[model samples]
Every structure is written in C-alpha cells, then in structure tokens.
Target chain A: MTDITIDHVTKNFAIDGRSVTAIDDISLKFPSGSFSALIGPSGCGKSTLLRLVADILAPSAGKITIGGTPPDEARRRHEIGFVFQDASLLPWRSVMDNIALPLEIAGGPIGDGPRPETLIRLVGLSGFENAKPAQLSGGMQQRVSIARALVLRPKILLLDEPFGALDEITRQRMNMELLRIWQETGTTAILVTHTIGEAVFMADQVHVLAAHPGRLVTTIDVDLPRPRALAMLQTPAFNHLENAVRAALFGDELKAEPEPAHG
Target chain B: MVGPVVFVVVLLALWKLAVTAFAVPPYIMPPPEAAWTAFLKEADKIGYALFFTLRNAAAGLLVAFVLAIVLAAIFVSSRKVTHAVLPIVIGLRTAPVLAIAPILIMIFGRGIGTAIAVVVIVSFFPIMVNAMKGFSSTRKNALELMHVLGAGWFKTFIKVRLPFALPFIFAGLRSAATSAILSAMLAEWLSGAPGLGTLILDASSYRKTGLLWAAVIVSMIMAYTIYWLTTAVEKRLTAWRN
Candidate 1:
C-alpha cells in the first residue's frame, strides 16, 4: 500500500537571479515493501529526489504519489517519515522525547496499542532513552533519528544519507541494522547515498543518476537474498556487483583519461 | 583563583581597606562597617524601595518577553519585512537606554510606569533578536518531521519553535534582566522616582556616604539575585544541554 511513484519529476532552484536545475524529468516506481537506493555523485540530485518525495521540497513539474495520494497529503496523515543527512535530533530533547515527538505533536497517540518499544530495542538504545542527542556519539545519534522516524508506524520511510556522517565500522554496522529493520518492519524505504558499495549492499534496486540536471542513467536490480550478512561481502557475486557499480560510477571516466606521468 | 563568595569577600575587604587607608571622612567615604550599620538602620526604607524597584523590573521583563515573541513572530513570518526592519531594531538597541529614559519620562511622566518603560527599552531588543534567530533557523529535518507527524502550525510553533527559541531567548533575557534592574534604578535617578537610585541620590546630596554605599550594596545584591534566579531556570529547562 505504501508504494511510491515519481512520474516525470523535476526541481529547479533560482539562486541570486540564476536558475539552476537540480533534478530533471526523473521517473521511477518503487514496488511496495522494497528497499531502494538513489545513488549518484555529489550534486547528482539523489538527496533532492528524496526531499521531493518527503514533501520537504515540491517538484517543479510532474507528480509524486505515496500510497495513491499526494506526498504532502500522505506526509500530513503520518503515512510517511523522512530522515536527513544530519541526525536532526533536537538538541533540547531526550531520545524518548525525540522518538515520541510525532506522537507528542499529534496530541498524544489515540491508539489502543502500547508505545513503540520495538523501535527502541531495534536501535539498541534501550538504556539511553533519557539521554540527549548531544550526549550520544554520532552513530548513536543516527540510531535515535531512525527510531524517531519509525515511531509513528510510517509506511514509507525516506532516508537521505542517514549514515553518511558515521565512521566506516559504524556505517557497516548501521547498514546491517537497517537491513534487519527493513525485513522486520516491512516498510517501503528509500535511501539516497553517494557510496557505491553501500547501494549494492543495502538496496534491492539501485537507481544511478547523472549529475548537472540530474536524471536517471540506469537502474540495477540487486537480485540478492534478504537478511544479507556483512560476511556476504566476501562472496564473488558481491564483489562483482560492487565492482560493477563502482566502475559504472567512476572507473570508466578514469580509463577515458590518460594515466599520469611516472614518478 | 577565587570562588564566587571569596571574590565578594575580597571586594568587600578592598573597599574597607581603601576607606580606612585614606582616612576619608565618614561623610565623604564611609567605612564598610559604617555602611552596613546605616543599611541596617534604614533597612525598612531600603527594603520598600528595593521591593518597589524589583516589581517594576519584573513587570518590565514580562512585558518585554511577550512583546519580543509577538514581534519576532511578525519578523520571521515575512523575510522581506525582517530584512528591512531588523537594522532599525538593531539601531534602536544600540542607542543607550540612559539617554532615552528622560525622553520616556517626559512622555509617560515620573512613576513606576516610566521606570518600566526604561527597563523595557533596555531589555526588549536583544531578547527579540535572539527569538527571531532561533525561530527562523528551525532545522529543515525537524520541520519535515513535524510536518509528516501531522502537526498543525500551532502545534509545531508551540512544541518545536518555542522550545528551540527558549535557550536563545533565555540567553537574551538573562542579559536583559540585568539591564532591566540596573536601568530601572537609573530611570529612578533621572525621573526622581522612588527607588535605590533615588535613595543614593538623596544620601549623596546630604553627604551621607554611609547611606550612599549602603544603597549601592543593596542594588548590587538585587542584580545578583535576578542573575542567579534566571540561571537556575535556564539550567533546569535546558537539562538536555548536558
């Protein structure tokens, strides 16, 4: 029910009397309950695309639908949640406060069900409920942000570089954690990232975008099994996929240019 | 090198030493002992004036808080108006409150009203500017979170913007509160309103240096209490700042 459809979406920004196209005529459909990644270089509109779908930014043309309704309307009905590159945890709020923010603003939960304890335990931040975002490390903060996004039982979650700020070890762990959460929750999630390995490792479908008026260049189906372990990176198929995605992104450009002079 | 109480003790010691060393006349430079004695002797009169001035200062601060919030709401709601009027507000802030107090007194007349007016002008601008900064720069992620959470504008404004605005607003208020108390006394000085400033003025004119020093001490204590109270509230509310 939470399938997202973006049809001919475009975004343009006018800055200092100059018009700059951020995203141009990109159309795609994300099947229900699937993990997808929009991957590209910096300034390639991956983030912009997620923002458009989040209703944080409206597309200049075309239409976006989340669960058959406008993205903005869906957002307002608590049908979707969006996470940003920064943790975006309120510095003035505790982990519990941050997670409960959606409920708090909606004038408390009207549901007969108990509060979101599964999300709390999922992030492995059970003991840090009262702790503020500032007290936690960056990895811990990102975990809190993930918990916050999931608090309202959102059907579709959009993440924009949520782990881009973490160290490699933390990022890898978070990648695994995200897979676990996706499998458990069955939420249709979309991630925007610049890392090639990350896209192949986590996404069910990786949509590569070209920069400077960003448009979809290719869509690579991951075709990998669910609940993938970190050790899968040792597999030849994983290596082939990672290499292919990387080569598609950068290797060909380097090959086209001549080699540097020998030292 | 010194704790807060220790610093105060040091200051008191230095003041006593200066008066004693100079052998200054009791009428010209009363000793600290003499000042304390005078303070106790005129405790009733001093207490009334202190209470009155504090009441005005508190009222002035409250008014400033409400006004700053309303004005900041207006400013943030429109970027064009904010860009145009912000400079003017800053310009008014730069103008000294002491220089403006007499003109305010002439307009409002000499009373607690004039004193409150003086304090308001001294305290309002900074608090407002801070509120404006805090509200306008609400994190895009937070805003999106609120939006997706089905929060109405009122809910987002109250729960998010208000709480976010608090630290900066408190910072501005903490600064402004001190100015409010000081300038309340100063306004009394200019307008002949009945407070510690008037007491100091009266004591000085009568060459009662002991009373003058005593009133000044009372004034300092008042300022310290306001600072401590605001600081305590700030710490409690911003426990997340840890």
Candidate 2:
C-alpha cells in the first residue's frame, strides 16, 4: 500500500560543536494513496522531515517506514520520488533527457513504468522535449521536474514546496495540475508548504508544525470534495479549513491579537 | 577581428621604426624584415621544430587533463584524501619547474619523455584544482536527487557531476594551454631536443640573430593560437550556457 509512518522521529544538527534540535520527537502518518500537507513557518523542519522520509538524511531518533519497509530499502527499490523547489534539472540535458535521468540511474526502466515521452505529454510539456532547462521559464521548468518525478511512477511522492517559486496564478494552476497527477498516479503524496490556502486546498489532511525545536501542533482534516476546482477556492468550506490550519500554526499569536485590538 | 589586426600592424610598424632609428645591432635586435627573411629561408627547419614542440605539448596536456580529472574524482570522494594529498600538490606547485627540470631529464632521459614530463608538471595544477572545485560545487539538490534515485558514486560522477564541472574544467584547460607550449619549449632547451626552443638556443649561440627572432615570433603566435583554439572548443561544448 506504500503508506508512510513516522514513529517519534527527531532530527538534530551540530552547529558550532553544539547539537541543535531541528525536529523534536514528532509523529505522523500518511495513509496509502492519500495526499497530506505539512505547513509551518521557516525553521519548522518540514523540509528536514521530507529529507528524513526520503532517506537523504537520517533521523536522530525513532524510525520511519514506507509501507512495511525502511526508507532506505524503499529508496533503493526506486519507490520514492522527490521534487525539490528549485527543479534542479541538469543544465546541459534537454527536457526529455532530464526526465529520463532517474531511469538511467535505476539501470533502465523499472517494470512497466511510463516512458520519458509519455511523461512529457503527461505534464503537458509536449513540444518542448528538446529544449534545455535554461531555455524554459520557471513554471515550465517546474513542470519538467514534475514530469521527471513521475517518470518512474514511484509509490510515494514527496514534494518540498514545488510551487513555492512561481507566481500566485501560476502556483494555483500548478497545484491543480499536481492534484490531478497525484489522483491519476494514486501515490502516497506528502507536500510541504508555507501557504495555508495551498495546504488546505491540495491536501486531504493538513499537519501544522511549530518552530524552535520543531514539533507538530495539530492535524486538521479537510472535508472538501475531490476533483477540486479553482472555483472551490472561494467556497466557505475551503476558507474554514484554511482558518483551522492558520489557527494551528499561529494559535497563540492569533488569540492575543483580538485582545490588543479591543483594548 | 579588425581591432586585433590593426593592433598587430601598429606593433610591427613600431618595431620596424625603433630598430631603424636606434640602429640597433642585429644580435641585440634584428629588424622585422630580417626576421621575416630568416623565417622564409629556414621554413622547413622551423616547421619541423614547431611540429615536434607542438606534439610534446599536446601529449603532455592530454595526459595531464586525464590525470587531473581522475585525481579530482578521488579527492572529491574522500575528504581525508584531499586533506592529506592537497598540501603535497601545493608544495610541488610552489617548487619552481626550473629547479625540477634537471631531475626530470635525468630520470626520463633527454628525449620527448622529459619534455612531456615537464609540460605535465607545469600544467597539471590549475586543471586539478579547478576540477576539484567544480566537482564539489555541484548543487546540493542535484546530489540529493541522485541519492533519492539510489545512483552510485560512479554513475553520479559520469552523468551529473562531470557535466556540471565542464565550465570549470574548461577554465582550467584554457589557463593550462596558454602556458603548455612555454613549458614544452623550456624542457626542449634543457634536454637539447630538436624543438623550437633548441632552435632558438642554437640560432643565438651561432649569432644567427635573424633566426632567433623568427623562432621567438613563431612561438608567440603559436601560444596565442592555442589559447584561441581552446576557447573556441570551450564555446562549442558549453553552448547551452548561452
């Protein structure tokens, strides 16, 4: 099923010979084929959590499991696909080549996974297959990265602010495209984001985190129906979910603001 | 194009004028015409010497390039090795090539081997250092992507790291190439090889000032041409950067 479970995971960094806790004993679960979002301000260690799950960085304590296997095992089996904020495509490689990179790394196509050309069309980048990364705009480059992330058809998709660099209009469009792709692939997706609206709109469950020895504050489930549209952004239910996530994120400060204004 | 041509013409005219005005002796400074006449008379000899010198420099540079890349890969793979070996490399680089040429000739014998060794010793440092920087400077995200894909070090190096390091490698190559001919010529002088460096020394010892000046001019042109050619190849390879 490829569900992810983080059992009391923690991450620490050594700065100036002192151990600084980045993620403090946090636990969460992302069920199979479900989309979840982690939202927090900077220093919240949301990115670190993603890295830990991808086995790019190890947890200082506790354990992480994808389906029933450890992250490293899942990773070695080519079951984890990560999309970074910067796209990170090789400048020398064309779009088609960049998307095909993981396949090459895996020692050729793993099973009956989608081909690079199929992914190019899947991400709606049809004619630009031969174009180099530098020749594309930021949004187009991100699309290429998304296509690349999906090329292997990994069971779990980890996105670390993939649309954070784009303009708002483009961000919403990419978000919609991502949701459609996630639904089609049926991957266990976890998105780390800063925007409350994005977290509420794209995720089935939103996990709020607090900084300074980062810890989870709360998890809010969105009741919004799927095949979510741009028009759903103005719906009261979406606004309500967004507010719940905001409250979880800025609960103390938000409560204090009303008293100061009233006084 | 026009600017360089005009500059060269002006430079030649000034050289001709200075020699005529000062009435300098041919040994001290031959007129431009004297050097040109000497080049035409000994064209075959000068051509052969030039060909030999070019071959030695090219061979040495190719060896150095491959060696530098392999060494850089090893250094990048381990910080302990880099820390241990980099100082010795730096020490070698700081030690004067002139000081080492005699020992190299004794070891390698007075042949093209000595010339190639000298060229490698002279041109290796920049390429190796620049290559190390390039290999290390690969983007963190790219490396992470490789990690996520479970690509081993060799595949990562070939597919991602090597291409990323091309511009830096080329930078080092260009720097090495400009000096490559100079080092090869120097080696020829010490080893008594029949290259342009030996030609220059022989012409001067025989008081053939015209031939000496001609050899110097030809060598200067070769150095500039090598630099231009390296840059041209770099442009073609890194065309995606534009």
**Model 1 Cα lDDT, one tens digit per residue, A1-263:** 78999999989999899989999999999999999998888888998888788887899999999989998798777767777789888898788888888777656653542275667788899888888888899999999888888877778989999999999999999999988887877889999998888999999998888889898888888977878888788889888887777766674685686878999
DockQ of predicted candidate 1: 0.63
Candidate 2 colliding pairs: none
lDDT of 2: 0.93
In model 1, where do residues sit more than 4 Å from their true spots? A110-114, A254-260, B83-110
lDDT of 1 by residue, B113-222 (tens): 88878787789988898898889878766777777677888788887788887888888988998888787887888899898888889999998888899988888888
Q: Which one is best on TM-score?
A: 2
Off by over 4 Å in 2: A257-263
Cα lDDT computed for each candidate against the true fold: 0.85, 0.93
TM-score of 2: 0.97
Candidate 1 TM-score for chain A:
0.94
What tens-digit string does per-residue lDDT give for candidate 2 at A1-263? 98999999999999999999999999999999999999999999999999999999999999999999999999999999999989999998899999999998888887889999988988889999999999999999999999888888899999999999999999999999999999999999999999999999999999999999899999999888998899999998888888888888888788774545555
